[model samples]
Target: MIAREWKCRVPEAHAEGFTAYLYETGVRDSSATPGFLGAQIFRRPLIGKIELTLVTYWKSLDSIKAFAGEDISRARLYPEDEVYELEPDVDVQHYEVIEHGFIPGGL
Candidate 1:
């Protein structure tokens, strides 16, 4: 499996709206792709903004290409992103999953 990670920042006030928009766009769109395994969203409170990270799991690079086009390194943005005043990373990072499991009795 592969993990594709992308990050962006938005105003604290826009956090809620941006999260919903992310689900309607990134999460929903990626879920429809063939090789999409799953996705996780993380948020951190910053001084005046909220940082959001989206990590999506995929079966393979080819599968990612199918969804992200040939240039998989580039971040995909939606037109509505401007509404939230998003500051998104221009590129994404991909890592091979060496290990992924839950520790017993640990949450």
Candidate 2:
């Protein structure tokens, strides 16, 4: 499995709008993608800023490539993102899954 993670710094005022856009735009598309397993979005609120992180699971590297293009290491922002993130510090990360755990104790 492959993990695709993105960290973004968004303006405090646009947090809600940006979060809404994220889910309505790329995430909705990604969720329906063939290799998409799951996605989690995180938020950390500060006095005047906010930090957002998106982590998504993919079945394989090829799946990631199809979603992110050949330059997997590169980061890009959606054009609609500009309305919320005036200055976005975005980062895309890739991880190699070594192992996964099961419900040893049961749910």
Candidate 3:
């Protein structure tokens, strides 16, 4: 099992919009792709520093490459994200899963 990670920073004002963009663009698209196991987004905010992290589980690097293309680095920006951060750069990191668990959502 593997979890791919990407990191970036954007202004707090653009946070919501950025999240919306992730859903519309990345989450929706990547989840639908083959070999896409799952995806999670995390945010870390400080007094004047904010960082956004996107973590995705994939079968393998080959699986990710198949969906995202040859140069698979950079956040796929949706039209909506333009209103948020002026520019977003993606730094990629891949991790091997040590352990994982999940609980069913009951409503």
RMSD in angstroms between candidate 2 and the native structure over all alpha carbons: 2.7
The candidate scoring highest on TM-score is 1
**Candidate number of the best lDDT:** 1
Q: In candidate 3, what are the lDDT values of residues 25-101, reduced to their tens digit?
A: 78888898889999999988956546778889999878888767766664455575556664456557778898998
Reference-based lDDT, each prediction: 0.96, 0.80, 0.75
Q: Which stretches of candidate 3 lie over 4 Å from their true place?
A: 72-82, 86-89, 103-107
Candidate 2 — which residues are off by over 4 angstroms?
Answer: 99-107
Order of quality (TM-score): 1, 2, 3
TM-score of candidate 3 on Cα atoms, chains taken together: 0.78
| Collision pairs in model 2 | none
Give the CA lDDT, 0 to 100, for residue 103 in model 1.
84
Better of 1 and 3 by TM-score: 1
